[model samples]
Target: MGSREWSIEKRSDSFKAEVLETLSETGCLSVIVLGASGDLAKKKTFPALFNLYRQGFLPADEVHIFGYARTKISDEELRNRLHGYLIQEKNPSPQHSEDLSKFLQLIKYVSGSYDTEEGFKRLDKEISQHEILKNSSEGSSRRLFYLALPPSVYPPVCKMIRKCCMNKSDLGGWTRIVVEKPFGKDLESAENLSAQIGELFDEPQIYRIDHYLGKELVQNLLVLRFANRFFLPLWNRDNIDNVQIVFREDFGTEGRGGYFDEYGIIRDIIQNHLLQVLCLVAMEKPVSLKPEHIRDEKVKVLQSVLPIKDEEVVLGQYHGYRDDPTVPDLSNTPTFASVVLRIHNERWEGVPFILKAGKALNSRKAEIRVQFKDVPGDIFKSKKQGRNEFVIRLQPSEAMYMKLTVKQPGLEMSTVQSELDLSYRQRYQDVAIPEAYERLILDTIRGDQQHFVRRDELRAAWEIFTPLLHRIDNGEIKPIPYRPGSRGPAEADELQAKAGYVQTHGYIWIPPTL
Candidate 1:
């Protein structure tokens, strides 16, 4: 529903200017995968492109993919590395092998250093040759550069692209870059990175991707809140007591201990992934579904968030984390964090938005739980059953359910807990949820910014967490120790209880089956 062109009646001059700068969807496509030899390109980026290939989104004649990195591998070598990474279909067709072979043939590899013009010049030459062969000699080609690389190298890589690899075509041809996150360590660094990149590309030309926004359940949030009349009148502080956005992983950072320690749980999850979720759940309805309109509301909500109070946060490090040779012996980095964010807006005044995330916990799941306020005058004593909670489970099984108080099915008139469940597997048996990267990459191709992070939005997010992160970096704050395979430090639960969150005991959600 959101992919439509802006309503002609509501077009602003700025919007018209923005639309003109984007590439024509009909131009020849050149997709360059930077850091293509790395794990991300091999596992996610290439696989996603292949999916688009089989679905005919990438016409064999018009789309050519280029793998650019310093790995010094031949095109055939790169194809062989990626062949095993693509997820094979459960059942294959007679022509599946032939289709796979053809798709592999379309990719070319360009080897070079990220900071030098030598590599980028070669990349540009290859792309230009392809464009000219396809009748786009005058620079009428669409160029997309995906950086599946580390944050430390983004500056030089971006500079090289800006210097030597941008498209020369002016007739509806354009160049855009997609960056993975950890945009920076804090507000100061994040602003600097933004400024550095801003000098090279317009905000519209930079796509800052956060994969969580592409999740099937997260994408449904706006429609679930705004399109349903039943929720319109009951979604504010008056009806809701506390909101909990939680992410838990059953295992430790396996082989990522060294990398994970630099940016703790808060940076890894809460700041980008969970906070974006909070904005969608709490923002007012947009004027229209236009990308700018939707993003504008998100920025406003983030700006309204108050500073973090030290007393409202709990940090923990798991027991066996230091065992990883990569982790420093005296590291105080947190593997778990539960933070309360209070928005100063009228819709959520005095309500606590708890953002919790952790690694090496009791289970693996990401979810949002909205617990409604208790009944004013309790007639059926529903308090015994528990406060009404609306839960949106994001993974393991994609589902949304509302826990309500209802009478037992027997002659007894007592209230009991019940749920109105909508499990995606049960309800849509024939549909396969697209991988988050696949949907996001498609959005980048279609020139949709609704699901991508905006610049000011990134700034506001950093503004909320930078001060707290600094305290942790210094010795002012220390992470409490907790055992692996257990819920985070007990202090976290105490903090939750102190903040008006009442946990409902003895109730679990079980997905309904065939």
Candidate 2:
């Protein structure tokens, strides 16, 4: 089938109709962002909304933007704060300035407490006012409430939204909630959170957003795996040696350790982001690309993963982390962690999946490295040559490249490693790559759950890491110290070595920054 037809086939008839209507007509849509004064709102949420507006993806007159928080800020102040983050480059064009002014007019702010009914009632009144002003009484108005707040406030906020802010079902419009992750600290907590939200909304109405899943490279994993003939036979235990799903950041939290300390590197990055990538890399092909069908495969792969052993884990905290004014002096929170997972299924029984994530590391990168096993017998005496590797760099310049051995250019019979690269900047230079938050927010607007995590998938993911998390917390496992600029704890290298990963000595991938 052609690309357009295939895409239509993937979506439900109702969803296709909705998309068509949204594109062709001006519908009443209100996007209410809770915790608007926070960094996440300014840095990501508002910025994404503005981009959508600038691109004409959002209706000009029929849509409204509401920002709610406990802070007593006027709409002008909120817009000013959001303006700096809304795509104004060092040298913006006159059209960009015009677009910014137009986008700012759509946003309005409301001061409110998350737990109180009165505040939510006021919010509801504000939302309804827009509907009334647009003369949408006869037409339906969709409401999307984005919870940009912390997990601690999720229950009360969700309750408030359900009780006071939800749209009436009789009005023909629907209500959807977009939740950010660290879904819960553990499996039980996650289930409880899910149950609470489930009480208010159905499965279809809840979108568990993970920005990583919205990444262009991550979204491409399925297509790269299934559509490419080269990868089909090589993506198995017999051919693949080990997979390394790594996330590294060069910068430490500059006095912003409150949240990071509460949920260490494991809960912060590995559990949700890296594991989601793992599922995509290892999952069996779904029967179709339907949301539930794709999620079923992800759940299956997660279920097959055996509990990670303590011996296979390495935890590290960057030196001077406790010295951060915001971090407690006695904090044992891990700024870095590397753990090995062994899937017990037939296709991947012996292969080790190493998940590594860290803050204050050597460089900023998030990449999946799949190292294939070496040839049984080499004819050219190239045993020293590294095993083949298929790498998908998720961030810091998205790209995919395969490392393979080839004969050296000289008369010598020696081999050298070369890459068949597909750097995004080099290939799709003119195309704009949307931010993760942008794509995810757009998906939520379209009511597409394929990129969002399902409740079962969330639970299964937590199940894999919760025990290890508890052990680290209960046992107060002291993380080894590594300097802020270093790679990570020395033991992390040892852990990888023990897990059968062969690091190439001379080869390094320096991604092109465009």
Candidate 3:
């Protein structure tokens, strides 16, 4: 992507440079990669760190990586395992070689269980050996804890770290914790979970990760709204008909059947990430880009979200998670969920915020579609153009396009629907889009809390969904099953129909073909 098209401004080089300076001066020693042996660690987390190191965001020296897990693996074995996933180019440049070597030297592994005091002690000892620990004390020390384990382990792990390790440290900088998704099973649990984590760490220190927020297109929401004058006046309930957020996948749990059964689609997607994005697109502009300020506005927008009715929400499950031969079937798991939500704020009372997510259905795509209300009293057959949508595609490709009514060329006074597309590939054709984990990991070290989720925001989100979770658990709601590779349950369509909305086009972009 062009410097302008990317999340951080090209002119913000000054800001980024300032952040790097702060990080270096902060005397942070080593990054603790919790659940280091998990799938997230291998596939997303560590790769992101490596990318940041290669990009010069991380210090070449004095920075250590401690891989903490209960896998009982040797450092050599761990490095080799990590190396398998690390794609290194042949004939690396001298600079890259030097940086990689320095990074490797700082890397080590510690085996420990999240539930044990002994485990936390071992992790503490490993961290203390690093020079960063020697360099800063009390408030100035910088330690970033990345939790890549299952959500069930989050509270205990966080509590242990806080009680056993964090309290013992006198760091001058910061202590930041990054946890992965499935924040809670429902609203009340989410609140309780947030409360548990919040008690252990200050709001500023907790980073509840939603990989989507780290995405290039996702972060660009602010720039798309505030930086440009074309969208603001038009971005209100008056002009917009509805907003749709779709997080779809074509694959099932892939042996993660147990976890899928517990969280399902709503808790997995809508409760945190997708709702955060919708708020960003709909929120009033913050006075500055300060982390809390941006997050505050987002929280307000979410709080303004009207509680949804049973009829407006649709839940579905794929063929039983346990029934699949690859893994035990975990039935009664709603792998798919769709909801038509309304934000009761002045700017968006009537607009429907439609959210749909499912696994093992249709295709893999994550996008936000903003449908505009038709022009009133238009002479042209305006219903055709009434389907105008501003789509932000996140997966398979990162791009933005706006569907509008245009006069057909050489035609009998007719208007055709077409998109004003700005494909990221076509723009900056060669720049590699970094992974979410990489961007977020770098952000943690650099002290840019803008992209990470804060504790209050997490609590507010939970408050919005707690009732739905309770209803589902009480069997007041039943999941409507959809066939594999289909768009989702029939109820999903009915939910949209009730709101007078429809997907106007056949699948415009398909990932399998790509």
Candidate 4:
């Protein structure tokens, strides 16, 4: 369908069912971000919260923000560090400056140790004071604790929050916790982590975030699949040849190798982000659009995926990665990996779902390419005919386009590739696309688990990749080395060829401009 015909306004009814409930029940809300001085807080968490405030999503006077960390810095100093990262471009308008100042006024800082109960008690005092000031009429006050810290501290932080920071009574507002990705290195660790947190809070109160689920394009997958009838019949293995979900980053991890080296690219991206995207692409239609219903379908697809074969996987480490001071000298971590997943379901029994992700590659992009089966019979004798392919771009630009073969615009009557495109920049020029974190944070505030990962879903995903991960970690396999600016290891190309993926040379995608 064209962009104009399938515009959000035109299709609002189809998607609106998922957002039936509102979050108006919560009264004065207090958001406390742990590891406030960390990179994740400064880069994503604070900026997303500020965007929510600037857009008037949060009640200006009633809502309060607290930054908790071990660093001994004044509130003004913390705000100063955050101000540079907030969405203020060079030479902003006076109104923008005023809005930023007002948002900063709501944020307060609390310095404390994660393991110490005294610090948490003091932090709770700060929150309680704000609750008393804003919610004097006995209305419930909501508390949201965002753990922007590492996984090592998650257990202690959860314990401390339950002991010292949880809501005093259910009569008022309830409390929620937001956690970031890389849930664990393996299945056992992930389950252990979940058990630790499950003892303190219910599953409904824990938001295991996968930012990829919040992306505009990723969120649109449901609308494109279930809401649009044009794709229903052609979405299975009968007509589709293969599906490729690829993620590439142009730059290397310069100073962040300490964290990246420990997790590697597979644990960092493939296990969580790319795998979530695969579930969306291969899942069956849910009975309803509710959070749990959608998640139930996602889990089914992951369960059907066969264990990844060792030969079907190709791992590579970027050249000169050891040069980074943070990376261990003898580290054999893989910066890139391509693995094939076969779903043994009725809908996708024979189709191959190729998941490839890498850093320090030839380009920066994230896309899903679904190649369809060739035409049963052809009348035109053209050597340049291309298979029908549906492409969804998730980053660098957001778009959905289908490549089809059409007669060339001449008397020669040759077939050439053409597209029916829906570029977001061109179609929704005036709308400001919210960041992934922004959408996810709002979902958490509203208690919407549709876009977040469930505990069982996390386990199912781990079950599919944990065995392969163990093989790599046990030194049973070694990663091939490839140049920083190259595509990836040469073996990756050979793997694609064996899987029957055609490479059309000299074809490039140009992102649409606003």
Candidate 5:
């Protein structure tokens, strides 16, 4: 996915030059999963690699996978476990059994502690041998270490990788690391973590993975906004009323209660995922589509966000959250939160950017709703129907639709809500949309930073929410309890209305029938 997405002709000459340079190093690729014994490695890490292998992106002759952890499992044991996980997720048949067998043959497991050099030494030896066998004296080598482990171990694990697992060949060889997030509890901790990792690797070689940025619709945003001329004049403050970025879940923190309790919905979802989406939605057009240029624009948007007002925030906890043994009886952590961020920049100044996320809600979906201002001096009285809304649904059923007022089909001069929809599944039924991880992992191999988060970009994001997060942690603000299968606290809706979001009633955009 990265190789294809990066090669688009729209890329800046500078960007193309940089990518071409990286492409020149046709080294053997080695993907090492640090916490290979964990659920994330089995479910997402290995499965994405398998998909890439079967798709021919990772040529069997050029790529090898090493799974490292302290589980002490044999190579065959790990492969067997992967076979089960892939079968479970991909279902009865994703590919022919022969292809599955060959893909599994590429994996080898090693037991290791995150902080120790002894294990890393052995891992390095294995990787060096593989590279030596695959490449000639003139050829380079490429190594990617995926830290599927916890953030606490990042520093030591990264240190070990730098010390023992760096590429052995200096013939244009490179080493890259992919780290997952909850970058930290707040600004201070995040910076500390960044400093630790920064000492071991350069920023260009570090990939901060945000799965949301890899979503197909999210990636389509720049193309939708910049490539189309129709939206140029209407995308700013004067024409747009409000923007809502929302995430919902129909189930509680069933097994992740312990982890979810520490961060809450604000840190877990709103601060990172929704915030990243907001940057793309509200940012001014970049100087060019180069990775650095695009990320610079994102940083500007984050820095421009004004401090959040208490009146514009609502936090809620589901009634059954405390029932989980891992959750404290008096926990103030919010399972649901609606926050309104106002950008200080001219283009988005008065418009409210409302971000909402919740667990155990009535439905499951993530979407961006851009509500357009009502028509001025309207003779048709379409404002009575509802404001025009452009919605981009990110999951469950990926789609984009525009809600507008039109005359009722027959004759009576009345306005009705209608939509122009592009439902991906319905429109492109034969094209398989690759998983988010698939694209990002591939991007790591190709050294594309357009979709990944940057250091200062991350710092700016943490600054916006850290003050509010600290307040939540100190119990100055508490969560209002709501029923499990509900739309969260009533206060959330009131806050939305207060922030100028007009809910369109009696209008739902149904996906077109196949």
Candidate 6:
């Protein structure tokens, strides 16, 4: 599925001016993308950086860029490759030629395995040549290392950087590292990874990225709750009957089946992105927006997740991923999973938190639905009809809508559902949502760790699903069958049905169509 969450809007003139001012004052710079040639770097990173550069987020003459990868290519070839990925090539902007040339001047490529001492030395040497580093302000130039590589490569790379690249004794500013998702296979692994990486970099220096947190609406969660009077009062279990977090994708493994089949939906999405969203939705208010304060609340939410029973969870695999010509026949990996997680905290006690996510399913949708407790002793006689619901759609529609029963206009006191809607498109006319990558990349440079995941939060998330992963791997559980273009395996529906939840009759279910 296409990324539908973030869109880039030029920062207001004052904000842009402030960013420029900050860069000039700090003399910080980005460096040697760990997995420069990987999909994320090519498709997301480069485009985002280029956008920032094009928009003057960074001072062209002062900023420096570097690429590190094993593959060796001439500077010309590398520049051409990056251009193809970063731009449409044809019908380029009048400013494109100058911008690309300026960017290329800042960009450098060094080929070597990040684990080796030689590799790290080469990277350090290459970075030292950059104007930004050479002109360092009486200290080591502030450095940002973006690790876009796989999980397996993270620790070794960090160790190498610490051993061979970091100049802690130097007067230069501090070093910050950016890491991608799928932090580890489970809780133990996540902790191990964290501890190992911590040995090299302080917790403050390491930024664990969860791009979902960068979305405007996702960020709006805190503001929507605390900034407004309406949401917080109804946020608890006493008022809210149930909460559903659905992250659905339309595409299967595609050609990445070989790699993705090894780690199903739970490990791939729920553990990091989806769980981060859940925490934001369920977390207790922090005393302040300080990074640690916010993160402490998130970890508490994660820790509060009640142990999931096998019977309470359901798993499903798209049929095509197992036997279709496009995917390996032996693959039994699940593309979808749905589970009910309860939080033992007083605020959410006895309320079910339904978490469901999948790929190659009916549609591409990311949404959270909060079903409120039925209006106290409803005056209406109809028994099946329940109370109102509040939904936040993160993708496709990018809107918030609430369903409340209202009296029918006619003489009969019949009730009908009415939606109080806030459509992003209609409400925010001509405004673009910043791309997640852009916001995240910008945050890294600004040293804002509030939106990123922390080691403890990561471990807490993994703890919740570790048992489920082991069960799936050891053949202790069989995936319920679900067809393409369908909601999911019948078990998913039964899951809600058992909890007395039926899909509301006349509401729209919009997933990301792209």
- Using lDDT as the yardstick, the better of models 2 and 3 is 2
Worst lDDT 10-window in candidate 6: 1-10
Q: After superposing candidate 6, which stretches have Cα over 4 Å from the reference?
A: 1-11, 88-92, 96-101, 132-134, 168-172, 324-330, 380-386, 407-414, 509-514
Q: Name model 4 segments beyond 4 Å from true.
A: 1-24, 136-139, 382-384
- Give per-residue CA lDDT, model 1, range 44-138, as digits (tens): 89998988777556777778999999999899999999888864766666577777889899999999999999999999999988887877756
Model 5 scores a C-alpha lDDT of 0.90
Per-candidate TM equals 0.94, 0.94, 0.90, 0.95, 0.95, 0.92
Give residue 217's error in model 5 in angstroms.
0.1
User: Could you give candidate 5's per-residue lDDT for residues 1-514 as a string of tens digits?
Assistant: 4454445433534654564456445777889998998999999999999887776677778888999999998999999888877763444554557678898999988898888899999999889888778863433788899999889999999999989988765776689999999899999999999999999999999999999999999999999999999989899999999999999999999999999999999999999999999999998899999999999999999999999988888999999899999999999999999999999988998999999999999999999999998888999977777899999999879999999888887868988999989999887665678799998998888878999999999999999999999999999999999998999999999998998888888887787788
Please report the TM-score between candidate 6 and the true structure.
0.92
Residues 34-145, model 4: lDDT tens digits: 9999999999999999888776676576689999999999999999999899856798788888889999999999999998898899999999999888753343778999
Q: Candidate 6, residue 41: CA error in Å? A: 0.6
lDDT of 2 by residue, 310-390 (tens): 899999999888887888888888999999999999889999999999999988999999999878887866557678899
Q: lDDT of all the models against the reference?
A: 0.89, 0.88, 0.78, 0.88, 0.90, 0.80
Query: Which candidate model has the greater lDDT, 5 or 6?
Result: 5
- How far off is residue 178 in model 6, in Å? 0.9
Provide the RMSD of all predictions against the true structure, rounded to 1 decimal: 5.0, 3.6, 3.4, 2.9, 3.7, 4.1
How good is model 3 by TM-score? 0.90
How many residue pairs collide in each prediction? Answer: 1, 0, 23, 0, 0, 9
* Best of the two (5, 6) by TM-score: 5
Regions of model 2 farther than 4 Å from truth:
1-20, 23-26, 170-172, 512-514
Error of 6 at 266 (Å): 0.2
